[model samples]
Target chain A: MSKEFIKGNEAIAEAAVRAGCRFFAGYPITPQNDIPEYLSKRLFEVGGNFIQGESEVASVNMVFGVAATGIRSMTSSSGPGLALKAEGISNLAGARVPSVVVNVARGGPAIGTILTAQQDYLSATKAPAPGGFKCFVLAPATVQEAADLVYEAFDIADKYRTPVYVLADGMTGNMMEVVELPPMRELSELPSKDDWRVNKLEQDGNFRSISSYSPTAEGLQEMNEASEAMYQQWDKEEQRWEAFMMDDAEYVVTGYGSSGRIAKSAVKELRAQGIKAGLIRPITLVPFPKDAFDQIDYGRIKEIFVAEMSIPAQYADDVRWATKSKLEIISVLTSGGVILETEAIVDAVKERV
Target chain B: MEKSLLIAGFGGQGIMLIGKMLGFAASKAGMNATFYPSYGAEQRGGTANCTVIIGDDEIGSPVSRRLDTLIAMNEPSFVRFVDRMKKGGVVIVNSSLVQSKVEDKDVKAFYIPANDLAQELGSVQVANIIVLGAYIAATGILDAEFAKQVIAEQLGRKPEMLELNMQAFDKGMAAVK
Candidate 1:
């Protein structure tokens, strides 16, 4: 419980150590450069491996190589870098390797700026793999949440045998705060297995091989079926969300990461002036907490404004899937570099309420 | 609860240095603290700022909103952050850069001629230290003795500039006295 000052990005490095992560592979990029920089030195001190790969493409492949060894591995990058990793990421899914990728999201359609945007939601969770596989995504709002969720990411990825991503942004990643590091005694190493090993055996007729190609049609069918079932199970078992001031509220504002921070602050100042605004934050995005929407009686509430750093329009498709009890859903979206200010949220809430 | 301050000015004006030394002192006193300097282009010619947060409890947001305390190293920073401060917040202005007064009497404003003090000490780069001394003298958030300890620990890291930096810090602190 001792006090220490730390920035959000460096705390991810410390959390990686606490989470028993032994391998880190990443390239330097704005907003998230601190993560790799801190790990490059600390990995050596902790007897772990850190590789600043040549490019984002190389870093993604490196993630595949390291995680194949059944180690807890990770990589971080921004929007463009993430795009380069997407092709390799599909392979990771096809191979069923567990890796945690952190994206300190930045604005873009193409290299927009080194600032931040939540527009990556559609790109990440709905990554355009061959057959369409889903990746679990967690959005952290506070520096504490940012640090703690990173540790959670590694555990969840291994447990689900899927990629887990912590989608923070430049503001959240760069913000400074005191990190309450997990106790050293609480450290637990992630489980490692030999099944992913190639061409090795201790007994007669026991050699095994791993490949991206399926040797049999039936084998491919069975694997795809299994992947779907696993994803469905994740949908049921692993969804997290927080609803604050939702009880007896007329307006609900939904946001994540930096936008969520601004939302909370706006709510506080608005409450001081007597406006009732609530928040619903989805900590897990792969298995989006779609059910929580059912619990909301939009018949009573006047509106739901989706405020995000990216186009709030991205979530439009999902919002339509809501078993919606009649209510107007508005979007407060912005893009390119600047943080979504608390004043903006308050103004938006005032207009909606 | 954690409170944060952002001291902004040009590179040679000493805002970043003061912010770092304050954070160093807070850390030495066993308090949670962080100091971040905004470098790169901001350090090249225009304005520069360092954000510092000190806390007793775990801090949530490291960035400042309504600062509990502030030191505006330049006129633009003073004009920019003045209205953003909480009412009754203590703001130490470097009169060398900003000669104007706060329009309101609610906020406590201290005009310290840090550049003049640095000249008196025959060390103009020590303006940051002078501002720190004035901030400490007015707010008393950190003890002066604790600052000396901070100077010792932080300066020890850079062996080449240790003696001169500490001397500058001492002279700056004495000027406020």
Candidate 2:
């Protein structure tokens, strides 16, 4: 129960280390450099390994190599860097390697800007890889939550035998807040890698190889079906979201990550002004808490506002897909690495209500 | 209750540090605080700013369009952010660099010769601390004694500069009264 003030990137890195991540590899990028920088010093202290890779492609491959040994490994990058790691991410997903990939996202299309932006939602949720494979995406609104989510991402990745993404924007990556870090986990507590890891081949005297390739068509179909099943299970068990002041909300504002935090503030202020505005924040962006959308009282809620720091409103599409009602889905957006202001959200809600 | 403050100045003015120190002290006092700096290329020598929010409960948004208070260390900062303060909010300015007067009638403005006071105290590098001390003195957002303690802890490695910083803080605090 000890609290300390720390930046989100540094907090996530510390949480990963405490969660028994023994190896880290990442290329330097704005807003996420602190993760590799902090781990370069911390992992060594914990008898772990760290590598400053030559490029994002090389760094993610390093993580893939580390994860193949059946140990917790991680890599981090921003939007442009994430684009570079796409091939490696696909390899991790295809090989069913349980590794953590952190994206402290900035504006994009192509190296847009280094400031805060939620532009990577589509890239992270829809297509993180070349194939149709998926990654578990966790979006944290605050630094404390970012640390907690990063700590939990390892277990989720291990359980499903897939890659997990801690999707944070530059604001969450760079902001400082008081966080109560989770206790350090013992190495012995980690799940045994005896069954699958390539290192165990020597002890078991069995031929085991980890690769993304499936030689036969039937084998590829089986792999895809297994991945689909894992995604289904995650949708059933790992869907996380928050509903604020929605009991009698007339207008429900929805967002995720940094945008959600700002939208919540606007909803609170709108309530103070006698307007019945509420918020639904999706914590897990991949299996996105669609149930939260279903629980909304459509009889009371007349409209839904999707607030995001992206002009195209990438997250709003998911909201639209989950929502069944014919209620208007309005988008309140700000792009180009600019943060969505509370006043703009409040004004948007006012206009609709 | 929740309070939000914006500290703005040139990149080398330690604007981010001031925001971090305030956030640290607020969190130490058992309040939830968040500090977000304006990042990117502007951090070299151009204008830099940060937003700090302190609340009794969990903070929702770290950035706000209208702030409770603003600390401006230069003319560009004052001109850029003065209109963003809420009505009746306090604006603390560095008189040595910012010559413009606060024009908003509803707002309360206090100008401190922070650079001059820090120079008189033997170092202009501590001008941000002087402005911070003045901010605490004028708004009473946090206890002056607690701020001094945080300052000492932050600068523990540089014991020689600690005394000078304290002197500058005291001088700035006195200037506000």
Candidate 3:
């Protein structure tokens, strides 16, 4: 329960270390450079390994290598760097290696601005891999939540034997806030690697090989089905979200990450001004928090405003999917690294209702 | 209640440090605070600014459209953020570098010669501290003693610079008085 005022990136790195992550590999990218920079020193102090990989490609592979040893490992990147690691991420998914990847996202189509944007929502939630695989994507709206989710990410990754993602924007990565960090987990307290890891096979007299390739069509089909079943279980159990003042609301403003934070503020102010507005923030973006939308009384709701920092509204599609397009969806969007302003959201709500 | 402060200046003027100090002090005072810095290639010499929010509860957005306070260390920064100040918001300007006048009828403006004051204290690098001192005096947002203690703890590593920074902070407080 030690509390400290720290930057979001540094907080995530520290939380990961406390969660028993022993290996970190990353390259420098804006908004997320602090994660690797902080971990480079913090990891060594904990008797862990830190490598400044030559590139994102090399860094993710390094993570894959470390995860194969049954140690918790992580890699982080921003916009363009995330694109480079996509292949490795897909490979990690196919191999079903338990790893954590953080994307302190910035605006993007290709090499977009370095400012905060939720442009990676679609990439993070829908198509993180090539073979229709999904990631356990967690989007945090505050630095404290970011730290907590990151600390829990390791256990979730290990539990499912899959890659879990902490999808934050630049604002969440760079912002400084007071966070109560979790208790540190010692190296010896980590889960044993005897069952599947490639290490200590000689001692245990049990051999294991890790690979993404399936020899036959049946094998690949079985693998894909197992992955899909895991995703379904995740949707059933791992869905996390926050519903703010939705008991009797006419306008529901929905968002995630920094955008969600702003929209919540707008909703609060709008409520103060006698507007029946509330917020539905999806903390788990991959499972999509469809239940949160399901709980929304569409009969009482007039329109659902999907606020985000991406033009053409990337997360709005998920909102539509979650609600099954039963309610009218209005997108409040901005691109090119510009944050969604509170006034803009307030004005949007005012104009509509 | 939540209070949002924006500190703006040239890259070399310690704009980020001032915002961080306020955020740290707010957290130390048993309040929740958030400090968000804008970083890019422009960090070398171009304009740099950071937004800090302090509240009794969890802060929603780190970025604010209309701020409760704006500390402008240069002319460009003053012109850039003055319009973003909320009605009756406090505007602290470093008169040494910024010559603009605050004309907003609803704004409360304080002009302090932070650079000159820091020079008299024997270093222009402490100009931001001087402005911070005046800010504490003007807005009464943070206790002066608590802020000084934060400065001491932050500069504890560089023991040599501690005395001068304290003097600059005192001078800035005096300037506001």
Candidate 4:
């Protein structure tokens, strides 16, 4: 298909449909309401189902229910809304259900602004719920990448028997750009779920019991170990990141999502001024892209600037863990729904240079 | 080449649409374009703005620290965003609504009576289109024909409005020329 002008949220919705997401359940939330709004009509055209549940909790549970049936299911929300889905997400994790959740995050500790923010990084990567479960988090800096990530998220979720989050901010959700959408997957071509799906119980006498809890401690331990195996496999295989202008770089700017995109511009401007700068943009927050940090020439690299839209520096903690305190890390931060400024980032680098 | 533009006005003044048109046209002309809109709780009559960046290469930031062009459709918008323009940038002020003069002498300013031209063309809603036309003529960053095609695609759903909008766009271009 040719490139078409589309908003990020809408592109993600369309991509999900093309990826054979036949069931969608999400409540309305600012910055991400466009996802449900687009799907409410678009899904019907493809003989799919879209439900705007009474609340975020209901919506997530609905997606979980659909996912258990071996159907591609998805739900999306902003920060506070995503918080409400946390318990349901944990339920999906415990049940070993494959689902896609989208968090078009906004600024917040609680009920904050309806503007863009990356405050949910720790929440999405570390612990989505209480049981120490993690979702494979994919962060997209551009609308095209956002669509591409959402399309791939369903596959990753199914492969890992885990939920995958297309982590985006309101800036990416609200922005419009030219995107070449993915081609539609035929329903027949979709992967069959006969083995694990809750089907064939009556005819084939193959009973499948799906539950998020196990009564015995040993059973729960077995489930935990099984999940750990999958996570470890992802740790070795799923780390995704981008290194821009890293060859012979003395300074590095590290960020994810929209902040990463803005940092790229700052790197360009700093390079124009004869400052050897590069960018380390993490595409997957869960795998954390630690190898990208390893690729950095610590001998020549000076300061590593971490740019984020959150003031408390939630993403910086991951960057710290990845770099292992090899170099001094400076931060360029914006809070309370403020977009990260390229000028602020450039000036921060200049001060260190 | 990359150009960053800011279009600001009241909420009902179609500020966002003009920005979308520019971005759509740029993309159709085989350039990379990103349109970042200011979405808030405010409804119509509240301040509205959007930023558009068009470039030949991958666009790093959707928002610009210093805009290459500013199309201010109101007095407050003109006052609020004039200083964000680069030294050699250009601004197209809707003179009918923005009564103020350009304070930044370094930037080129075109005071087009967008509302007057729209009213003359029979609809006050086309004022933003007039400003869009002026922007195309002033900057020449995008092809005028591509912009006109975008107008027809965006506003042409209602066939009767297409010709009038085309005229408003042309008048806007004429005002700048």
Q: Is candidate 1 or candidate 3 better by lDDT?
A: 3
Residue pairs in collision within model 1: none
Question: How large is the interface RMSD of candidate 2?
Answer: 0.7
Candidate 3 lDDT, tens digit per residue, B1-177?
899999999998998888888888887888899998887657566899999998998789898989899999999999988999889899999999999999999999888999999998888999999998999999888788878888998875787699999988888888885
TM-score of each: 0.87, 0.98, 0.97, 0.98
Residue A7 of model 1 has an lDDT of 72
Q: What is the TM-score of chain A alone in each candidate?
A: 0.93, 0.98, 0.97, 0.98
lDDT of 3 by residue, A141-238 (tens): 99999999999999999999999989998999989998898899977887776677877575557677887789999999999999999999998998
- Model 2, B37-111: lDDT tens per residue? 988878565799999998889899999889889999999999999998898799999999999999989999999
Off by over 4 Å in 3: A202-206
Provide the TM-score, chain A, model 3: 0.97
lDDT of 4 by residue, A203-289 (tens): 658588787799999999999999889888888999999899999788899999999999999999999999989999999998778
| lDDT (Cα atoms) of all candidates against the true structure | 0.74, 0.91, 0.89, 0.91
lDDT of 2 by residue, A235-330 (tens): 999899989999988889999999999999999999999999889999999888999988987777777999999988899888888886457889
- On DockQ, the candidate that comes out on top is 2
Between candidates 1 and 2, the one scoring higher on lDDT is: 2
Error of 4 at B27 (Å): 1.5
- The DockQ scores of all candidates, in the order shown, are 0.32, 0.86, 0.78, 0.83
Query: Cα lDDT for residue B74, model 3?
Result: 93
